[model samples]
Target: MANVTKLRCNETVRIEQARIVALYAQLGQQAAERLMASAIEDLAMHMVAIDAAVQKNQLGAFDDAVTSLIPLARQVGMTKLEQVTRDLRDCMRAQDLVASRAVLARLMRIGDRSLSEVWDLEDMSI
Candidate 1:
């Protein structure tokens, strides 16, 4: 989370490429890009909340930050970040491991939502 905040636009774009690779493995390149866009859109909603919290210097704003970031993380195959955010939230509430695991499981659900699967690894035998 802090790492994301530290990254510049170009760095973010590079990380974005990693996400593209993840989505492409399950769907195809085009579908993966589209999914990335959609995920970005979803994350934007939570970003709004995060921005608000950061402006106020309030630790309580972490909820909004996590909420905003997870959708984007899930979209980009960043299951770990999504899990960490979920873990923090659940622990903050009542220290529930089951809930955290469930949240992680939901992150994996993105693969199931893919429309198709294709790969351009055919002509690479050379």
Candidate 2:
């Protein structure tokens, strides 16, 4: 069961490149580019909110941050970020502060990596 959970987590952490490609195909290059930029901004804002929530040990704020992150992360093909945010939300729901803290750290790392991956894709003209 643990292995299965790990496998699922690994899968969620990866960006769905096909989704991004399909967005570009459907929206056209300029519109897709703008949407990506907006999504990145939203992600950054939410990250800041999450960081603040964690620092203050405010679960409500953390929950709010995660809530805002899910759809935006999905829209941007940030599957890992979306998944980790969900994990954090669940930890909060369970009132597991220790687990929530650990998940928060993981979220920061994955969020950074996912954003960089998207930037790299953009650089490659993907």
Candidate 3:
């Protein structure tokens, strides 16, 4: 398997962290920030376990971690961030169906069209 680090990627993690920071700003300077700080403390506390699950290929455990982040993202009103987290969770839950079988059909159709165009070109000596 590819490195677990490739799963979230630095960009996604940065977006997640930025969403948390934006939530902090939206919640105000002191009191709400303190509350979110506490939550971050909790997430940090569990980080090792979450990372371990990801590294060990424990899909359920990894989903649990991604799931845990959603409420926190929602609390901050980071809807897109929340959606991305949910997508990751759903992919883990669905496994094989993550891409859905229909995409294969679509690609095949596209390939067939391209091949047909090639045949026509040959016939035209183009």
Candidate 4:
């Protein structure tokens, strides 16, 4: 009998709470909420593009999509998500499909959780 060990990758998602608070303070609650929602939507839309590129084996498209996502993530202080995003970009740039697959999975996980973390703050008083 052969043994198969599954890899469960649960990464820690670090949200810069102070950055978010500063945003709310600078822009006020109403404006910050709107911007946050829009940014989240933008992130989700680009993540879809990245997934589609990965599925279709289009490295150039994947790289471009990931490149665009980097700044948006940093702006919101999603430290872990941004770091993973950069890692994925490096993988794609190296033309390393094997590494890209694993990195892509991590990026997606961090991305989704980061979005939720920001979205959840929409109603909370920072």
Candidate 5:
């Protein structure tokens, strides 16, 4: 019998504080909060779409959902999430399923954490 160890991927995510601050300044706190909530909701939905698409081997759907996510992530300052999204997209472009799958899993982890942090920080200065 062999001992099996589980690995956890806790990727470091970078959020752009200045960017978020500017958003609050430009839109006013209420409007910015509304917008941020909407964007976060959309990002979560897209992650679900991407996961389902990947499971079904529907790359086109995955592309559509992921492409939409990059700008949304950038809008609210999820820079690391944006970069990981691109990395996964690049892997897909190269037609390397192995790497693409690996990156996809990483993307989901980063995306989940980034969204949560953003939502949690909505009430305070980041």
Candidate 6:
């Protein structure tokens, strides 16, 4: 019997806490909270679009969704989410279905983690 090792494909998802704190400092707590809430809502919609595009194998739509997600991800300090989205975009642009699918799976995982982290931060006052 050939010995096989399982490879863990999950990437570590993290939010840039300092950037979020800086936003709060610059914009005041109430305004920063509002902006974060809006960004989170927008990101959720984009995630849905990305999932639909991937399901339909629509590369252009997938690319577009990722493109829209990048700035929002960055603004909210979703570092891993932004990086995975970029990777997914590159795969879609190359027309690599297998690679794109892999990246899409990673993106979904990171997106969920990122949202949870943001929610945790939202519950805390800076």
Residue pairs in collision within model 6:
none
Q: What is the per-residue lDDT of model 5 for residues 1-126, given as tens digits with 9 covering 90 to 100?
A: 999999978777768988889999999988998999999999999988987877677889989998999999999999998998899888877888888889889989999999888977886863
Tens-digit lDDT track for model 1 on 3-93? 5456322111113345556567779867766665676556545545544543444447756677668776666655644554566466545
TM-score winner between candidates 2 and 5? 5
User: Could you say which candidate leads in TM-score?
Assistant: 5
Candidate 1 weakest ten by summed lDDT: 115-124
Best by lDDT: 6
Q: What is the lDDT of candidate 2?
A: 0.84
TM-score to native of every candidate shown: 0.39, 0.84, 0.44, 0.90, 0.92, 0.88
**What stretches of model 3 exceed 4 Å from their correct place?**
1-29, 41-51, 96-126
lDDT of 6 by residue, 8-124 (tens): 766677799998999999999989999999999999899989989988988788778888999999999998899888888888778888998888888888998899889998998
> Per-residue lDDT tens digits of candidate 3, residues 1-126?
775554421221112345445555677656665765565454443344444554465877766776676675456343544555455455545764434233323323332343333234324421
On the 0 to 100 scale, the lDDT of residue 42 in model 6 is 93
Better of 1 and 6 by TM-score: 6
List per-prediction Cα lDDT, in the order shown. 0.49, 0.84, 0.47, 0.84, 0.87, 0.89
Q: How many residue pairs clash in each candidate?
A: 1, 1, 0, 0, 0, 0
lDDT, residue 45, candidate 3: 38
- Rank all candidate structures by their TM-score, best first, as comma-separated numbers: 5, 4, 6, 2, 3, 1
The local distance difference test score of model 4 is 0.84
Q: List residue ranges in candidate 2 displaced over 4 A.
A: 1-13
